[model samples]
Each structure stands twice: as structure tokens, then as C-alpha cells.
Target: MDSGIEIKVMNPRRGDNLVHPVGVGHATSASSAPLSSTSSPLPDERGLRQQQQQEQGLRQGQQRQGLIDFKPLKKWVPWIVPGFVLANIVVFVITMFINDCPKNSVSCVAGFLGRFSFQPLKENPLLGPSSSTLETMGALEVSKVVHRHQAWRLISCIWLHAGVFHILANMLSLVFIGIGLEQEFGFVRIGLVYLIAGFGGSLMSSLFIQTGISVGASGALFGLLGSMLSELITNWTIYANKLAALLTLILIIVINLAMGILPHVDNFAHIGGFLSGFLLGFVFLIRPQFGYVSEKHVPPGYIAASRKPKHKPYQYVLWVISLILLIVGYTVGLVLLLRGVNLNDHCSWCHYMSCIPTSLWSCKSQQAYCESIQYGNQLNLTCISNGKSNIYTLSGERPSQAQQLCSNLCG
Candidate 1:
């Protein structure tokens, strides 16, 4: 009875189906026992864990691919700087043709290379235009601008140059300095700064240089330098090595200004341009990074929640002051220019502002002068007339006698 009860229980546990005969019970037990032992949960769990890990790795790779890569981005090219260069070259070519620039002549080439490529300053009354061609082309002239109300010269003269070397030097400097500024600030802002600064330089030149025909892009270039300083100061946080950059810029400005102390350089224009650019820099070139937390780390919801600018209070104060000064400067400059304020009348000694004082660099009311010429032991006086290339010779034994004769004839 005990053996029968055990067999009945084992048969039900093995298989309850009618298809299995009584003899097949041992076979079923043998096959099912091995299957149950081999099929453990550990292997299945390991496979599942591997699949999950692969999926997680794939998701991580996708996220990395979605991130922005700033390395491959191309740098912005500045067209305005090149445009200014081309325009300057074109104008220079036209001036050369107008001046009847000689071809393949040593003295002519040398003159163009040096200072005498154009006519003498005193030959043109009131240190008028460098040449008749320049005057016709609207070169800046104190008498013409003040007396005739050709206020346009203030803008036009910035494009004019005295000689080949002069234009070459200025255009090179423009390309060097302007490209960087335009690249950083975009063309529109840079363009505005350049034009306004140039105008400011011209206005200042008119005020201080009361007796000369001034031309060239030096003032505009100086303005660019000034703007660079203001840019550095305003965006101090953004630049790497702030102190080094500031020191370098300051050094460049000082060196250039020192060059102005030399003869015939327009220092007033440099100062005006620099000052205008410095003031305008505070107004126009403020960077987005200034006085603000970087947007990359901020949450979208938090950024949207704060509608106010993240700028410091000092930044706002600077902006207001800069705008006010710029507006006032433009207003005052235009008013004074239109009113025909004769700076010469008000400041007779103002010519000294443009030139250094020395025995050789003395100011003259008339252009004519006497030059001593030596022919062996005998001395001769050459009387050079204003606006005329004709040389008159006064022959004499003594140098003093010859000088007296030249004074009588030339003066």
C-alpha cells in the first residue's frame, strides 16, 4: 500500500497527461530533471544586464553627438576693412593722375616716396590744398571750409592723401587694425565708429590747424586705436590675459602719439579721433558677456523668469554718459561748423598746435624765402617766389651782401 501511494504521487508530479504510458514515467523523470537543473536564472539575468548596459552606452553616445562643437566653426571674414583699402587705393590712383605724376623719374619717384611729391605748404595760400587737383577734389582747407562753407570737406578730407607713401602707410595700418575690430564687433558698428571718429578728427583739425590743407586717414586710424582701448576696457572680463592686452594697446598708442611730435604730422586729428573713439567705444561696443552670467550654465526656466538685463549698475551709468557725450559732441561740432566759426580769428597762435617750434620750422606769413647757393668761392642768393618755381639769382662777393640782395628781391 505504501509503494502504490508513492508511485501515484510521483506520476502526478512528473506528468498528468493521458498520452504518457505508465512505462514512460522513468523516461519523463530522467529528461525533465536534467532540463530543470541546466536552465538556472543566473545566465538569463547576466544576458539581460548586458543588453541594458549596451542600450545605456548607445544613449550616452547619442547625447555626446548632439552637443555643439565650436571647433569646426569658420572665423568671420571682414569685408569692410578690405573695402576701405580698395576705396583708398582708387582715390590715390585718381590723385596721382590728377597731379600728373611723372613716370620713371628719380626725383619724382623720390619726392613721392618722401614729402615733396605734392606742392609746398606755403605756396598754397593759408596752407590750402596740397595741389590744385587736391583742392578741386575737396581736400580739407581752413579758408575754404571756414570762409566758403564747404562743410563737406570735414568728411571728404579723410579719404584724401598727400603722396604715394602717405596713402600706403595709412592703408596698411587701416587693414591691420580695422580687420580685427570689424571681426569682433561686426561691420556695421565698426563702420559707424570709423566714420564718426574720422569726422571728429577733422573737426578738431579744423579748430587747431588753422592754416593748413590737411588730408589722410591717420585720424580715422587713431580713432580705431582709441576704440580698441575702450573695447578692451568695456569687455575686460571676456579677454584672456587682460593686463597684457591693455598694456600692449597702451604702448602702441603712446608710440604713435610720440611720432606726432615730429614735423608735419596732424597730432590734433589723432587726439580728436582717439577721444571720439574712446567715448564711442563705451557706447557701441559693449559685449554680451559683460556684467552677465554665462547663459550656457543657466537653466531655461530661470533665464526666462528674469526679464531684466544682467549688467552691473556701473555699466548702465557708463552707457548713459557715453550716449550723452556722443550726442552732444555731434551737436556742438555741427553747430560750430555751420556757424563758420573762424578758429583763426579766435586763436591766431593756434597754428603752433599743428607744428613744432624751432628755428628751421618757423611760421611764415608769406611763402617766398631766400636760399643761399655757393658757386666756388663766390656766393649767390637764390630768391624763390611763392607759388612760382622760377628762381632769381643775385650775384655778390660777400654772403651778407648776397642775402641782402635776395631779401630785397624775394620779400
Candidate 2:
């Protein structure tokens, strides 16, 4: 046997001096395990350490993956925000291009959008009248005035604009705030914000508009601004106070607001839109934020009785009344809209400069003064000497030819 294969053996029965051959029974005496090797770890321990490192790497990779997942959320936001911006663009484009002909100019477009309404305003006919077919039918003259009130404008008025520039500015602001809110809160909520805000703005306009026609979506755009301001306020603590941004935004709003006070600018509509948007935003947005994060829950009676399944008596009545009012208003508006009031009809018979326009008369004029003209054997006569005249000459030579020209011209 080799020395490396040597082994030690002990027996209890043999005396101290007695010894046995350790290699007698076994062919190899040395063991495979080394003392140096025993001092160190075994294969299993090394494998476990490698596994722990691998797990740590995996955890780090998962953290990276989480961030990667979050980055893609922006790609999904276009559906909510961009969609509305596109829709507004489409509506305006359609409204503009569809009536580009000379007769259907901007004023004509305004009339079209107004659904041809004429009416006296409810409280102040001089302020702003309602604008809508619905509002037109609902128009009621003051008790003292027997004249039919101008048709109230609402829906179409919101879309109409004082000018192309007015439409452009309002549309631009709407895109900015609308897309922002839509991306953050999603389309459904953004749409609700837009509609409610717009209606609120319209209501404000309704209260203020006297004799001038009110138009444009700025009121609704203002509403969007209010809603966004609300979101910022509600999330200020969580979002790291965006004071600088808010201040800058406010400055921009103020400049535009000042512009509203300028000549031909509708300050009433601007103010109405702003206040309504602010109020509505407070009710729908700021209050909800507080409700969600409040340290202490609102008392049960404040919203509803804690134990009671039904709302409080006052709340129930208030809700009922609100619902009824909305229904009544909608019903009346619908009826008025279908009635198709025409503003031009009322103006057709109105006197202008005391000289009856050519439209009413079959002949030149009811009163007569003769003026003479001779061109290539044709003679023309009119009642007024220096008064304004419209003359047409056709290719002719003789009195018969001239008579034919006058007959045709007069005809």
C-alpha cells in the first residue's frame, strides 16, 4: 500500500503494545478529504453564495424594469387629451370651410350658429341675450314692452366668435389646458370638466349679456383653466409647490383678461366664464380632493346621516328641486329651439334713413323728381337729382333699343 493510502486503527481488546495492520482489510488507506480543504467551505456553500448574488442582480433588474414600465404611460395619454384637441379643430374647420362663400360670411355664420334667434333678455335685454334655438322659443318680452324679445342664443353662441382671431386664441388655450387635464385625469373626466365648465360659463354670460351678441368658447376655456388650477392646488403638496408655474400662468390669464376690457372685447363673457369656472371647479374638484385626503372625515350629517341609508331631508329636497329645474329648463329650451325664430324677419320692415329702399317698391320711388341722361340714343330719368342712383346700360343704338334697356333695367 502507498503511504498516501495509510490509515490508523484502534482495538479495545488488545493490550497497549499490541497493534493490527490497518491496511489488512482495505486496499486503500488514505481518505479523499484533506485538512486544508476541510478548513474552507464545501461546494454547497459556494453555490449558495453565487445564488444570492444572482438574486440581488435579479432584484436590481426588476427595479429597472419598473421604471421602464412607467415611462410608457405617456404613450397611452393621447387617447384622452389629444383626442379632444383634435375634435375642436375638426369642428372649427368644418364650420369655416363649409360656408366660405361670399353670402355666408362670418356674420352669416354667426346667424347660422344662433339658429336665427331674436328675443328680449330676461332681466336685462341690454346685457346679453341667451343664444340657442331652445332659448329662442323660451324668450319672453318684458311686461311693459309688447315687442317680441329676440331669440335667446346658447349652444351656437358658444361656438360663434367675434372674429377669426378670437376663435384662434380661444381654441389654442383650450387645447393647452384641455389636453393637460385629459392626460392626467383621462377623457371621461376631462370631458365632464369641459362641458360643466362651458355650461357654467354660458350661464354667467347669460346673466351679463345685455344688447350685444355673445360668442366664442373662451368661457369654457376659462373653465378648463379653473379646473387645472384646482388640480394644481389640490396636488400642490404632493407635486412640490408649482408656485412659479402657477404665477406665470396667472399672469398670462390676466393679460388676456385686460384685453377683454379693450374696445369690442366682451368683458362680461370673460368675467362670467372665469367666475363660473372657478366656482364649479371648487365644487367638483377642490372639495373632492379635500374629501379624499382629509385628516378627519367630514361629519356624517354634513354629507348624509352616518347610520341613515337615505340622504338628509334638506339634501333630498335640494336634489329634487335641482333635478326639476334642470328638466324644466331643458324642456323649455328644446321647445324654443324648434320654434325657429328669425331676426332678419323683424328687421325687413324697419325704416332706414326715411328713404324707402328699392326692395319695397315696384317702381323707382313713391315720390318723384326727374333727372335726365342721354347715352347712344338712350334716355334715363330718375326722381332725385343729386341723390344716389344705380344705373345700368346695355349695348343699344335707337330709341326702341333704349326703351328696351330701361325696361330691362327697371324690371
Candidate 3:
């Protein structure tokens, strides 16, 4: 038996569908057969198909694995921020009812102010409640807190506000800053920071403010600002434009603190809350991006080598420093508050300026006028001073009496 195969080649120039035999092969196997440029040289078609199928399956498997590994990031909603805002509004409403607040007028402002008044200068019987009414409520009065042991005022005062403008300013700040922080860190941490900061502010107020009833959430808002600063510092590496972010945050804090310099603003509360929040941020608000192992992952081993930290070494150092500072600060504040150390003894004007002496308003001048009139002495008078007319009359007296008295004195 003879085995042979014939090969054919076609010439394109002829343009005819014909093949001319080029060679005759003898005893040739499929494995040794010549392959065309377009044909693969594999001997077994099934094996080649199997290999191709395996490779295609591997690519498909890899794609499926990638899909399986992908996870959607968790979305956070700011329920706590809104909850706090609602609470503050509710408290303000309660205060309005208690103080018999008017709809809209200078009377309303005076009413709120009178309700929190601790001294004669602050009282206005025609406008609102007296200091007694505020004490009955939860106003943070130093005398009431220290002698009467009404320390709960420290917490309660944070929810109270003097008037519409006061609550509005505080709530606006809370919403703007608190919502973002609550979304990032969740409710528990933000709430904790807020409460602690508020308490810290209250403590400082009680320590220094000898007169007047202090209230409002300005201290807590300052805490949020401070926390933002610490957060920016700890997560500095992750931010694309850290310098810009830091400067903006610092500017906001500075502007807000500067406002405290204005008359009747509690600068101590602001300072204390900001300091507490700044320190607490390092302890509580640290993100996984700042280095520690993420809550999502578990370390295979307890050894240092097995636990990989993502944050730089300096971040950890800052964390430790912050914790220490917070501890020391709290300790000092507590000692001062508990020991009943009078801030006025050391710094007489620490709580308030001796005299702001504004051309528009002067508490000292008002106090002088009140003092000039003897207690229980009736007076009906009017005078022109500082390009404005002044008038005063006893509650039961008529305007005519004041005019007659003014004419008698001026004449």
C-alpha cells in the first residue's frame, strides 16, 4: 500500500478558478503537514479548542470576580443634625410660652432679655419675666449653680436661647457645620462631642460669669468648628488641597470667635467649647483614612507586622498629644470649677470688659444712671443728651409729671 497526497497552487494572473498540482507527497502524517499562514499548527483540533475555551473561561471568571469584589460605599444621612435643630426649636418655643413672648417687636427682644436677667439692670417688668423665672427654669446662673447646687443648668442652658435672633444664629451654624460632621462621623460621635462641648462651655461660664443667666448653643457650635480643625489636621494627607481647606476653616473659627468680643457675648464659653472639641476630635473623630485598621477588615495576626497602618507616623503622634492635652485641660477646668476659684479674684475684667464705651450703647453709663437714683425714691424727669432725648417716669406717674419735672430741672 502507498500513501500520498497531492498539493495544488493557484495563479491569480489567469483569473480562472483552476488549480495546478505543485507536488506529490509520500508517507506524510497530519502532524507533519504544512500549515497556511492563516491556519494554526496544532495537530489536535479538540485540544486547541479546549485550550482556547479554558483561556476564555479564565478571562470571564476574572471579570466575574472583579464584579464580586466591588462594593458600593455606604451613604450617610444626617438625621442627628436635624434632630438637634428640632430640639433647639422646641425648647425655644417652650421658652416663648414661659416668657409670654410677643409676636414681633422690641418688646419681644426685651422680654427674652428680661427673662434671663440676674441683676436689676437686666430686669424689665413690662417686657418679660424676672431673674426668678429664669432660675425656676434651667438658666445657668453662677450663684444658683454654686450655692443652690443646680448643676443641671449646665446641660439645660445649651438648649435655651434669649430670643429669636439668638436661636436663629446658633441653629444656622449648627445646621451648616453639624450636618456635614454628622454625615461623616455618624450620630453618636457628633452628639457626644456636642454635649461634652456644651457642658465644657457651661462649666467655664459658671466659673467666670458671676452675674447674668447664660444660655444658648454657641459653645456647642464652636466645638464643631474646633473638631473640624482637628479633623482637617489628622486627615491632612488625604486632602487634595489641604492648605486652602485649613485656611478656610481657620478663618471661619477666627471670625466666629471675634464676634464674641462684642458686648454681652460669652467669649469664655466659646473658647472652652472650642478647646474641648479640638481635643476630643483626636480621641473620637479619627477616620480610618488617618491610619488605624478599618472597621471593615480584621487583622490575621495580633503582631505589629501583621497590622498594617495606613496613616503616617506623625498622625499617630498628634493623636497621642491631643489625648494628653484634652486630659490635662479637663483636669484643670474641673479643679478650678470644683474649688470655686473666683476668676474675678485673679483677673477682675476676665468675664467682661471694664467699659466697652460704645457711642451707641454703654452698660456702664446705664448702670451709673440706675445707681444715681436712690432706692425707693420716686423720680420723673427728662433730659437731652448725646443728640437724643431721654425720658423717665415712675410706673404709676403720668407723662405730664415727667415733663413738669424736666422743665423744673432744665429751667
**Candidate 1 vs 3: which has more lDDT:** 1
Q: Rate the local accuracy (lDDT) of all candidates.
A: 0.67, 0.45, 0.65
Model 3 gets an lDDT of 0.65
lDDT tens readout by residue for model 1, 193-311: 89989999999887767665788888889989999998788777667899989999999999998778667688888888998999888888876543344455343433322334655
Give stretches of model 2 more than 4 Å off. 1-76, 79-152, 282-411
Tally clashes: model 1.
0
- Total clashing pairs for each candidate: 0, 27, 1
How far is each candidate from the true structure, as Cα RMSD in Å?
12.1, 17.3, 9.6
Best by lDDT: 1
Q: What are the per-residue Cα lDDT tens digits for candidate 2 across 267-323?
A: 545655565555444434431211122223333323311232222344344335544
Error at 408, model 3, angstroms: 24
- For residue 267, model 3's alpha carbon misses the true position, in angstroms, by 1.4
Q: After superposition, how far is residue 51 of candidate 3 from its true place, in Å?
A: 7.4
TM-score of 3: 0.66
- Specify the poorest-scoring 10-residue window by lDDT in model 2: 137-146
**Candidate 2, position 386, lDDT:** 45
